[model samples]
Target: MKSLFVTIVSLFSLSAAYAQTWSVDKAHSRAGFTVTHNLLAEVDGNFKTFDAKITAAKPDLSDAVFEFTADVNSISTDNERRDNHLKSPDFFDAAKFPTLTFKSTSFKKVEGKKYKITGDLTMHGVTKPITLDATMTGPVMMKGMGGKEQEKAGFKINSTLKRSDFSVGTIPVVVVSDEVEIKVNGEFAKQDGAVAEKK
Candidate 1:
């Protein structure tokens, strides 16, 4: 019994030691979306400010937790008028809900470098469960300033959600499609002192 208890404690410690936290390199990351406009053209926009983090124990990130948040007021589509409207009550009501966020509940590997992530998304004072398709690349080592070697990874995530489900927009479907497509591309850097074994 004593040996078994010691072995279990050791295993737990090893697993905790292997977990790493990777932070988004915002200068190289983007959170963007597209929605059909007038049943003809598509309007694209992106948030100017957003942050994300990933915590995982495995190099492949088979068991990962993801958290992301974006400032709703930083939304831009190039046209100031439309952007303001989006921030107003007709859409996001940015004053009431200044930020949109997502926290993952599950991260399942689908194939090589591909994963299905399910999470709770909160926006415009509402929360809903959503899933995204994700692809990951590289824990490539790169030399940063001062010639320090750092680990970097890239991710591409995509999802589609109904705007109405989050009470984001009340515009008729004919004017703006109910479906919104989200695309996020991010580069993450492993924080110092949370290093995992190289795959």
Candidate 2:
């Protein structure tokens, strides 16, 4: 009976040590992209609506789990005509595939403050595995509205993938490059009920 009790206690302790959940602050976070337009210059755009849930065992996010989704219809490139066209069947087909998503398969520490995140990205009714180079920074404390201290963490990610892989568009490389570069900047606030010490 004592051995069983001890084992159960150890399990609970381990769980407590690793329990940390963070909610992304959308107002302070951005999921955007840059792509070559007509092979003349790179155009930038952002998705206005997105959400992410992140959990980590450490402040550095070495073994974190991240799930992110963006509304396909929220894509904007400053041109209404272009944006509308992107949502058509020629590109995202937002009517059929309303969301683009990513769920992490692994977050491995590469060096100081840098990590390699591998995940499957689904868009335009297709899924493909992609690796992102990411950097984690900050666990800074700031006073909240109620005068309570809030812990904030930030992450920067960069990745590039071939649009053809997801069948986003039929345009050739000469017209609009097949490769798209993704930039993700996220700020997460530690939610209530977090027992782990902020780092």
Candidate 3:
């Protein structure tokens, strides 16, 4: 009976020791995406305004909880007219649905610093299931430009999505690939006072 009590205490302690929380630092972070323009060309773009919140239970990133939002008006392709067109009713309709959002449902760790992040992507009044293949880098301790810092984390996620799934645009057997390839690289600062930080 005494052995069982000791074992239970030890297991609880280990569970408590492994949980942590982190925050997305926008100033030091970025959100980007790419799509085919007019069927045959590649256009690179990014959202200048966005926010994110993240939580994790371990360095492995399994069971990490996260949510991100991008301001639809902040979309930029480095051109004015095309940007305006994209914002119009034919495309994003930013006036009606002004933001793109993602919220994680689950995270499953894969081999060697990689994870499968499954989530819901809400855009243009539609929400769809999306999974990003993610790679984690650097939870390494380092000396800050100002002082000592511990475990800085960064991630890269790549996925190919069909815009048609979300009713983004219609293609009538001409011009572009309905499948769009997108990649997002993010850097997060360990948020102080985050409840998950200790995990």
Candidate 4:
């Protein structure tokens, strides 16, 4: 009986080890955020250029990983002045801290297509732990420029955090929302094979 139990456990472990590993496709993915303005409406914006590394494996998403970096100057709001101001000392201070980053520490499945990701996010030279809810949008097929067949998976992640945690809090505290909402339109490409194996 013990031998059988050990064999089963070993097989499960082997299966789990093969489940997660992927390369993020920058072209179809996004790292964006929205903040409330004057207590009325939310202003939407995004980082024009960035890169991500992600993996979706392990039945529990225990082997998942996420990392991304954005160019400070690439912030887009379709308005020049406001965009410039965001790069100023009062806000992002682009010249000093030119990039923002996030690295996942945990992932939990919540029903079908729904997941919760907890990770460390760094901005303004500060790092803090944050959790975001993500949903698998779907899958698609694409052809590369060289005619190579490619498969893509999409996920939408949403999360909120207090700006002060990363030291971006500079407003009167009453006017600006302490919490910032982030949305990610993320896509991942298969790394040769599926991450299959449940442990």
The candidate maximizing lDDT is: 1
lDDT, candidate 2, at 174: 88
lDDT of 1: 0.92
Alpha carbon lDDT of residue 73, candidate 4?
Answer: 82
Residue-wise C-alpha lDDT for candidate 1, range 75-117, written one tens digit per residue: 9999999999999999999999999999999998888899899
lDDT scores of the candidates, listed in order: 0.92, 0.88, 0.77, 0.80
Alpha-carbon deviation at 181 in model 3, angstroms: 1.7
Which prediction has more favorable lDDT, 3 or 4?
4
Error in Å for residue 118 of model 4 = 0.7
Candidate 4 residue pairs in backbone clash? 19-195
lDDT of 2 by residue, 1-199 (tens): 9999999988767666666888999988999999998889999989999999887766655557899999999999999999999999999999999999999999998888888999999999999999999988877888878899988888999999999999889977888889899999999987777555344
Which parts of model 2 are misplaced by more than 4 Å?
Answer: 1-18, 194-199
Q: Cα lDDT for residue 167, model 3?
A: 71
Q: Could you tell me how far off, in angstroms, the CA of residue 74 lies in candidate 2 after the best superposition?
A: 0.6
Which residue pairs in candidate 1 collide? none
Higher-lDDT candidate of 2 and 4 = 2
Instruction: lDDT for model 3, please.
Output: 0.77
Could you tell me which residue pairs clash in candidate 3? 19-198, 19-199, 20-196, 20-199, 21-196, 21-197, 39-175, 39-176
The Cα error of candidate 1 at residue 115, in Å, is 1.1
